[model samples]
Target: MKKYKLLWLCTVLVCLTLVFVGYRAKAQTFNSDLPFLIHTAESLNGKVTEWTLFTRETVHLASNKSWNQKTKSLHKQFPNMAWTYVKNRDSKTYTGISRKNNYVETIKLLSTNVNGKSYSFLIYEVSGKHWNDHKVENLNKMVSSQLDKLYDKKPVIFSCIQGHFSDKIDNVLLYEKNRLLKSLQAKKVEALEENDFYSVSAYSSKLSQELSTKKKEEMNVQIGLRKSGLGANTNFVIGTPIITIEY
Candidate 1:
């Protein structure tokens, strides 16, 4: 009886482990908006050259000592990073950059004092040019983990990707607008800006992040395409909510 009971317990434990793993795998599949961006780029036959994720929060600090403590804490958290500081008349900023073989991560802490009250704005960003689908999962995990630790409440995140196609196509803006709307299941809210070379602003249900304007409409998922002035390549930018980096 004891031998059979031991075997049954082992089997149950194995089954439970498998179930947990399966659940985590499923959760990871639709966790972030990066995969959708990657898919759209692939569909357009573009090679992704750069991508970025950024989030920021503002919090009340007690004093300059608190600011220093926060910076020291970040230094310990990311020991490999070197930090630089800049000060102006009203505020001081600390910028730290960590460069790996493929990706670069930046953290900025801006502090200001107003009428004896101190405030700090914390910003975190990560960018890379070379990554595959599996590596993207790691990037998402890294961003989520750090943001969770840094802020008690969730911060709004912006994701941007840049890529290029070897061959230039005519009417690239209209081509991308239609393709992305189909790929993202999104509708055009309004063209924030459009020209012969670029298109921006749209909305999609597939994305979890969105922004609401006074117009009573939500805007998320922005796309921009511009032709290379000298080459036969076309460059594109895809961002969720909005693109913060310069195109």
Candidate 2:
């Protein structure tokens, strides 16, 4: 009886140890997880520009400290801040944008952490009118490069070892995770004709509505970028892909 009791105690300790370690790992990962949406737009010119938002969780993006700073020099002293679908690759397909295009660097927004404070990221590449070969080669590179500019950490150059991706499965043209992903199309042409502010507000409003729908649940989302499009108008619209979560 004494021996059996001793063994049981050891077993319980082992199980507790495992649970503790697992919890710690998850906590660390969550802190660094930069949740974001990937989308695409065209310059006033016909250039297709790819982009990503760390997150515009009204709480952070609304902060004055976020969108303005050009350099990280003030990040410590000041404290910080911060697309579309063309196709489906397959059962093994994971969508991310390329960073080779110049538009990607300019339009790219900085990180905006929410209440829990998680960063954001976007990957994009531009191909003229066809997406016969939609590659994810720059997904990691572009993200890493921008990480260097954003954070002071040395190993900022990083990749998501454990992240999820999807294609336009339901909205067919806008969302990747079928059944739940919502579509938010911006004002077609009239908004842009007025000026950049109208177009910006229109784009932000649509994105905000789509995000609000997802907030009802507890899932994480990574918006996808479409490599090709039907060319709706002179403006290169930013397309959204909804990623819903159950846990």
Candidate 3:
């Protein structure tokens, strides 16, 4: 009886240890940029107008034959999407686009030459113009999983979520700027660029990706606001590690 009890206790301990280690590993790998971007945009009473997630990674192939083979393998991963091949003087690209009622997804496998050196890159982007928040989370997970399988090393990821208010706030650019900073819990503003019509602020967020150093400042979150030409509406864009989309 004593031996059986000891074995049971040992088994429990081992199982708990395994669970804890697995949880830690998962927590380390999980990216929180998209979720937090959505949450923050929604908190500001702005409806989600559009969001895009992009990733690019460089790959190496021994020969043109291997490059073709790699392209074929990548196409197999997205069998449902139709692919279009475009070859230029200096580059070759295979672009696949899939469309749904609410969103669109585009994937590109490109090989090009620069300064007499050959380079290959894989790019995946998903964008939607509708206001479905639930679908955003699902799309983020799907994209993250796909990228993990495609890249051996960590790829550069850029996420941008855009929203708009139907009626503008007084001094919308500055007003929302302060509100957004507070909501993000960002104490210091790393960078700022503004005009009468629009403004962009950069900050570091604990929930965002690795710090991006710019001019001796460490920043990862980028928020932009532009006054809409029509009505009193104000448009905003939030990105982690910087916003790439034109606002």
After TM-score superposition, the amount by which residue 55's alpha carbon in candidate 2 deviates from its true location, in angstroms, is: 4.7
Per-prediction TM-score to the true structure, in the order listed = 0.77, 0.24, 0.75
Best by TM-score: 1
lDDT of 2: 0.26
Q: What's the lDDT of the predicted structure labeled candidate 1?
A: 0.71
Q: lDDT tens digits, residues 159-179, model 1?
A: 888887766556665776687
Clashing pairs in 3: none
Q: Candidate 2 — which residues are off by over 4 angstroms?
A: 1-103, 107-134, 152-217, 222-247
Q: How many pairs collide in each candidate, listed in order?
A: 0, 17, 0
Top-down lDDT ranking: 1, 3, 2
Candidate 2's displacement at residue 100, Å, is 5.6
Model 2, 1-247: lDDT tens digits are 3443343344334323322232111121112221122222211112332222231111123333443333233233223222122222221111233333332222233343457564433222222222212344344444445545444432211111112222323333322222112332333211111111111112223232222221132112222222232332222223221211110
- The predicted structure with the larger TM-score, 1 or 2, is 1
The TM-score, computed over Cα atoms with residue i paired to residue i, of candidate 3 is 0.75
TM-score, cand. 2 vs. native: 0.24
Q: TM-score of the candidate numbered 1?
A: 0.77
**Model 3, runs deviating above 4 Å:** 1-27, 131-140, 167-170, 197-201, 204-206, 214-216, 228-232
